[model samples]
Target: MKNVYITRIAKFLPNEPVENEEMEEKLGIINGKASKARRIILRNNQIKTRYYALDKEGNVTHNNAQLVAKAVEGLCDDTFNKSEIELLSCGTSSPDQILPSHAAMVHGFLKSGNLEVNSPSGACCAGMNALKYGYMAVKSDQVKNAVCTGSERTSSWMKSDIFEDEVAHLEAVEQQPILAFNKEFLRWMLSDGAGAVLLESEPNGKTPLKIEWMEGYSYAFELETCMYAGGEKLEDGNLKPWSEYPADVWGKMSLFAMKQDVKLLSENILKKGVASMKLAMEKHNITEDDIEYYLPHISSYYFKENLYKEIENQGLHMPWEKWFLNLQKVGNVGAGSIYLMLEELINSGKLKKGDRIFLQVPESARFAYSYAYLTVV
Candidate 1:
């Protein structure tokens, strides 16, 4: 089988930085009743800086396609872009418009028509989904090269007034209202960013990384646990309230999704390719000591802490503190988080040729858990 490789990767983030403290102060002024509650939530989340696109009046801006275009341009400048590029796929939850998948916009921006472009809207998993699709296209010999881009500008939908009102109500009641208003709870954590990767059949030429195999799984139980949309537009031309409660209400949703993905992966992919890195490593011609790194999706601080506990319980080797610290610097870039970390690992010399790399991406019901098994080459 021909080896599919990740040839190039790049990312772009908004210039404006919104620190957590700044957000808290702003919210406090806007809704004095919720000042204390908002501060507590912000402090507990431990988010330092999040990027946002703001106008002169301090309103959030939405520039999803523009950022995606920038990332793609970076990839093109770094790599040779032939007119015959076979595929273009964009993974995004926050698209510029509901119509015309963001992929089409990217295709237009790149001015390439000899390729089939797919716009995948699997929420957070969109980017990984694009990668998986590109991998299959190249592995099947259907395409020689492909590009996958993930970009999101969630700040566009942040309704300050509605968010302030919701925050005030929640504080007065001492309870979060519902999923629809949970956006305020997470507003401080989301930022605007974009990342892109170019893939080819093999690294016979210059390239950054190579792909080994990709795996994915979906849990139907999480179908209604999370959702995203334009929301109700107001007369003032702003987004309405966002829903974030169903996910918490269905507390086990993510865990269920994880179990389903792990079960399928262990049986179909890992068992066939390599033994569990935790058990009988030497028997499989490998050992836990052989792995230099492991990368997984960065969901949240709480999720990460719980995941660490779970890994310890399972006796799996824990990643270095550096990996967790990196998350502190960038928060979570959605689908781009894992790939961005992979790029950093390679560039920082932490990864070397023949080093095994494992990446797991779990998306909400809109998408699903998408895993990739790659080796540094």
Candidate 2:
């Protein structure tokens, strides 16, 4: 197989930074009442600022496809155009539309002409999933290069207007006065942004990062869905998809609202991933001493210490100095996270040739994880 290296990386964060204090002002209060869960969630998330594609009045400035197109457009200078792109792969937990697929929409926005395109779907690990597609495409000699992106325009769904119906539905059904914690929790957690990378058989910059290996595991059989959207978890722990329900209740129940089984997440998230991380490292002969940087796509600071301790117990001890995170600044961009972190690290000017960078991406959608190793070369 041919080797693949990330050639160019770029990111598009929509609009201006919305500070923590300004969140309610921008996202708006649901049912004309302040969220009781907002402060507690934000306190644990520790997200100082996050980007949103909506204005104070809830007007959209950019859609998910537009966010991706902007980032891809930044991949090359003015001379480069989308028509030359060999393959386009996009991943997102939140696609603007369900039918056309995210890549097709992005291709339309780019007017990129005919080319291979792929759209991978999931939550946080979706970005890494897209990157792996590009890496394999170039490594297998199927494409000279591939453009891959991971993005989210979650602000479109997080707006208070989207939940107003559900709020009223709760009152009619269960006498619940407001949106449930499961439904409203994400409104304060998610942000909007997109990140893209160019992958080629050869390295571009003098210090390009080489994709040494990629690994992924799924535990859907061993675990129920920990996070989900477009459906509700039944008493049997199975999902009753939105299609199965009557259309009227869709908006009323907020069936499409993204949520997690907090109990499942708190229990298995750190445990399951570290076991696989240890085995993968052992199989690859990677050791604690060899890793110089660790980039984990954590949705909140709540997991920082727990992740470190778990990995440490498994013998991969990366000190705080070795950890590189932007969650505090970027909030949780879901699938856009790893790409954004890689972009920031590569631009930080601290990397040197031969440095080993470890990436850990955990997806709570169904207890999945994707890990990759990169060498600065």
Candidate 3:
């Protein structure tokens, strides 16, 4: 089997950092109720806050594609020139416009010199999907080097009207805005950032991280249960969250979405991947004990808890403290989470040559991707 290796990885966040307390204050939640509620949620998730890009005026910035291109340029630098790159894939949720594709803009900015480019817009797994595609292209010898980038600028999507109304709702009840915050209705944890990774075909006479194999499985549930972009109309004239009228009045959509994806992964991806890994380990006369690092997608604090439990149930021992705790600082960068974590590990000297690493990705779109790599040995 041919080997595809990661040559470089880099991540960039805006200079401004926002804490939960500051957000509450900005939202006019003066009472202690909001602060208390935020405390409870933060305590449970071990995330105090997240970062976002801000303009010179100290307002949340709204340039998603531009920042992403800048980050990719920084990663490419002297190591790999634009002409050397055969493919450029960008994974992002926040696009300036729906037309022409964000990838086109990024490609133009990088001056990729006619390199093939693809821009994918999945909810949170966009980054991982981009990486997976790049791996396939290189493994198939369609490209010698590929660049995958994950970038998000949620501030662009911020609905100031909705925010004001939500805050008003809390004020009416004499409670803090945090007290009125609902996980299902409001997404307070998401922030803004961009990350990039460079992948190159292994060079002769030089050892590189071996990409053993990868598999992806997706299952779609009813549209009413988990609407990605559109939904039914609501009684009021105002459009639903994403410009569509709201339907499914019960608001159990997110719950159903989570259940469907979890079920699909548990049945189709995890069971088979775990079994295959076991078989491959035995075929190579290796054991779980031989693995040194594990990287899994970090979506939420609750997600990490459930994932860790599953890992334990599978009898896999991991260095949770070193390998899994980085999410606190970065939050979730969508598909770039695992790759960013790997970069951190390598830079910190925790990931060494010959170490075995497993990467598991669970996307919000009811898809799961798994990949295994053995450090250059």
Whole-model Cα lDDT of every candidate shown, in order: 0.59, 0.89, 0.59
lDDT of 3 at 357: 72
Regions more than 4 Å wrong, model 2: none
* lDDT pick, better of 1 and 2: 2
90-182 per-residue lDDT for model 2 (tens digits): 999999988899999999999878899899999988889999999999999999989999999998788787788888876777786777777
| Candidate 3: tens digits of C-alpha lDDT, residues 1-377 | 34688777777777666676665443333222444455655665565656666653446554777777777876755656767778988887666677889889888766768889888777566776788788888888888878888877765334233244445565667775542233222234556777787777774222346666555544433112221332322345222453332443223222111122233333444443344444545555655566677676655575665655555667655557524446677765555566667667657765556777766655544333444454654
Worst 10 residues of 3 by lDDT: 252-261
Clashes of each: 5, 0, 4
**What are the per-model C-alpha RMSD values against the true structure?**
8.4, 1.2, 6.2
> Residue 1 of candidate 1: its Cα lDDT?
56
lDDT of 1 by residue, 309-333 (tens): 5556665656564232345566666
lDDT of 3 at 230: 29
